[model samples]
Target chain A: MDKKIAMVDDDTDLLNIYKPVLEKAGYIIKTAFDSSEGLKLYKEFKPDVIFVDLSMEHFDSGFVLCHRIKSLPEAKKSKVIIMTSAGHETGIRFSTDTEEEKNWIKADDYLEKPISPRDLVQYLNEKIFKEK
Target chain B: MKIENGKILVVDDEKGMREGIRRILEIQGHKVDTTDSGALGIQKGIATEYDIYFIDLKMPDIEGTQVLREIKLMYPEAICVIVTAYASIDTAVETTRMGAYQYIPKPFEPDELQILVHRALERRWYILEARRLREEQAKHLLEVAHEQSRMRTIINALDDGILIINQEGQAVLFNPGFLKLLDINQEISIGEPVLEILPTALRDQIKEIFSGKGSVNAIKQEITIHPPAKLVVMANTTPVMGKKGELLGVVSVLRDISELKKIDIIRSQFVDMAAHELKSPLTAVQGYLELVVDKTLGDEPDLYDSYLKRSLDRTKSLVNLINDLLNITRLEAGKVRRELNRQNIKELIIDRLNFFKNDISERALKVNVDIDSNLCVDADRDDLLRLFTQIIANAVRYNKPNGQVNITGRQNTHYVKIDFQDTGLGIKKEEQDRLFEDFFRAKNEFTRNITGTGLGLTIAKKIVDAYAGKIKVESEYQKGSTFSVYLPFAKQNNFTIKNSP
Candidate 1:
């Protein structure tokens, strides 16, 4: 099952690393370096999942980019993902996935940076494939 | 001043008996008077109010008992002893009821009469002195009592708890604060040992240590008590001293430093977040850049060379920024481990000088190093290195190209001093006071295009404080600045400097 994925990061190198990996796994990848460009690209591509880096050129850019994409009528149900570094994701608070709030820009996945290619494929399979 | 014994009066038909009694009493320092006849004795008694009446028992004119009854009626306290014979001695029992010293029968021994007279005089003197002293002592006691009550009033009014203990460590006097702070209530009493007033550990610590050589030395310790384990507190203890330099007891103020602990938690969080923010990106940049230059550039030479050069340049910039951020965060966290080893004064300056070689050569700058090589100081190596980085980097950053930065070190047995003098744009005197504060940039930020985030001296000061050393800056607006650091010398072999690359 091929899926379309859009990723946004202010760090060009991190975007370059994940874009190639996602593309080879049969997921169509779209990239943006900052918030305004990422939102425009998100509406046009309307990808199955969105991965936003927490810090862009400005801090908290990922939250801004994710919120803008989810507010749109066409992308409300899209599975939004937050990509982070290992130091970023160890222990953060989250609600259970079954809640109705999951419909809008659901950050159902987290991928730690220097992320291995195998773990990423399995994660995408579990969130996008297993849901079916 | 003289009150006669008031018991002896001489009255005799025979003048010689009268003279003998008068001569003995007068010799014994008594005031005496005599008469020749009972009529004359009665006349003297009536005229001058004599204390005793002595007449012949068988008087030719009048009976002695009759005269005695008249004398008793006239002055009841007066003693009237009738000088009589042995045959008439049975009647002397009546004289006892009549208040006589005793009957002196005719032909009495002169010694017996003299002893009687002496006993009577001393009794009068003793009674008078006893009565006088009692009144005097009562007045003195009242005055002393008033002063003690005033003293207790003053001690009670003091906010600091006051306690006076005897050599036995028994709390002889403790103010209201002691009992109130300890929650002992009004049930506390005098003579209770201090241990009974406080928690068990505090009592033992104070009693054991405070009584020894530590009496003058400060007893600063933190104690924790748990009541079923829900709360925690930090207590700071300071010793209280008396005017004579005596150790009264310890005054411990237990404030709950829980908020300070929470701030520590928040600080560690900031360090973690900031470190993660800086390091994760740098790691990716380093790792991936190494991968690209290794794998992607396989002898195509020209194309690979272009990519390698660009990546290394950016990687180095990221590394420097990471280093700067690391230095700031670590110093702020107080994580730099410091040792108090004797550091070679010249080697420290030389090593520090060598580190700036690449940086200084790029700008063609010069630094004068004037410290002797033999001088060494006790200091922390890594901490001193970070200090050097901040000071030297600041010295270069704030200076013009080819500016002279002088680094000097001098050492005595007790202390070692180092100075980094730079001929650069000096700080304004107005900003000199706040030069060591964090995140404060000079007002002339625009005039001097020194690229700094302003955490250099702030971190440097903290490091110096860790060693109990001092750093001071002397600067005038246009006259360039000199920053001096003084570090106390610790014993040799205190610091073991490892192999340096």
Candidate 2:
């Protein structure tokens, strides 16, 4: 069975650009435009990996979505990643490397924007297939 | 010391006696005026105010004692000597009791008259010296009083609060500004303890100074007073030192910095928002370019065409964002050099609408304009163009397919009112108040596909404000929005167009 993935962002172009590239790598992908839509998609698709943009309808939309997803019984098997351009935008870097940060952010990992397709695939493989 | 050149008046009925005294006194460098009649002597004595007066015991016109009494009444400090051949102890004692300095018996030698004149002049010098010292002291006291009052006036007129406390922590002096800044409405007595009246933070700072725990140099602290109103103040307390290097008191100057603090917070927030707005587009552009460069999708060039096109679109929007940022910066910094002209509002709207011809056609949006041909506003050409472009751009950009945009202009006695009504996705009621704030954009399902820097309305509002105009909006969710701009009519406005050199 193929590993399933979900991407949520307000930028339609970004989703379009990344979807084909990720699909070419043999992973099934689904996309949503906002937090609520992303949450609804997560429930229906139950994807193995989720990529959420930090700023969508709101700046902290990803954080709220991540917390909602982590609260669900099905979320334990899924890995959630929060993507942000905040490091470039505000000069403030965020990380979920520590247990406290991971718990508070309710995210499995974090990535900065302008992320290349190859790097994103590699990060996903390391977090998903390598651990298994 | 003897004062030799005394001004002397001799009032004697005896010609020989008067002449003899004048000759002796004149030789001693004294200015002598001898009057034969006692009445004329009194007149001369009072007019000249001679330092010393010599009167005979008897006179025909007025008694010599009468002259003495009259001179003493007018010039109380005057030195008077009685010279009479009928001098006896009773008469001598009587004249001496009536402000007479001394008595010289008549039929005396020239030496006796010289000795009497010398002693009387010495006494006259002492009286004049004492009077001069008293006058000098009074004038000095008056100048000191004036200086103190001037200092008080200056302190009271200052906008910054001032408080001077004694070493005992008592409020020795305070100004009206002090009371207002501290929000103290009660009558503060001169010797009131300052710690009780001051806010806790400032009171603690003063206590630290009095306790000698901190450096004695001026301690500057930012403190907030919260009660009736929130006030931020910069309190600079320095020890007032005396000549002996003793701490006399402390002088605290409290300046209200609340406005500056608020501006500082706003400026930082604006910077953060602007940075975030800029970065979002850059991220997309960079990602698209990177995907093209890496050929992430495949080896086919056609696959990258759409990505490149999107990148180009993002770059164009980035450029627009930068331009908007610069325009806002210039507008807010008051650096826009205005070229004022009487511009017809209807004509301007028509011209601006032409810029959106392609968008209007592409979206199938109908634009109907019914504006008065002669309605005009006195404003900078570029400012009005930018203002119109922003509002019109929003009407077209946010409108649904086959939407209708209605623009109308009318004039009143003072203002020219122009309205741009668009069948567009209107703002939520809760978000309406923040519509004109910097980088504040409505984030909802309707606005999801809209690409904007969110600075258009902010810049529009700023430009309108610069022209002393007002811009407001009336809208209902999912229906449409009407943006009304009220600018003063060119002819009715009091704006003076400064001629450029």
Best by TM-score: 2
Leading candidate by lDDT: 2
In model 2, state the lDDT of residue B314: 88
Candidate 1 residue runs with Cα over 4 Å from true position: A57-59, A86-106, A130-132, B1-254, B282-322, B329-501
TM-score of chain A of each: 0.75, 0.87
Candidate 1, A39-93: lDDT as tens digits: 8888888888888875453235565566677677887557778766524321221
Q: For all the candidates, what are their Cα RMSDs to the real structure?
A: 17.1, 5.4
lDDT of 2 at B298: 64
B235 in model 1: Cα distance from truth in Å? 8.5
User: Model 1 - which docking category?
Assistant: incorrect
- Give the DockQ (C-alpha) for candidate 2: 0.37
Tell me the tens digit of each residue's lDDT in model 2 across B338-371. Answer: 9989898888899999999999999999999999
Give DockQ per model, in order: 0.11, 0.37
lDDT of each: 0.64, 0.86
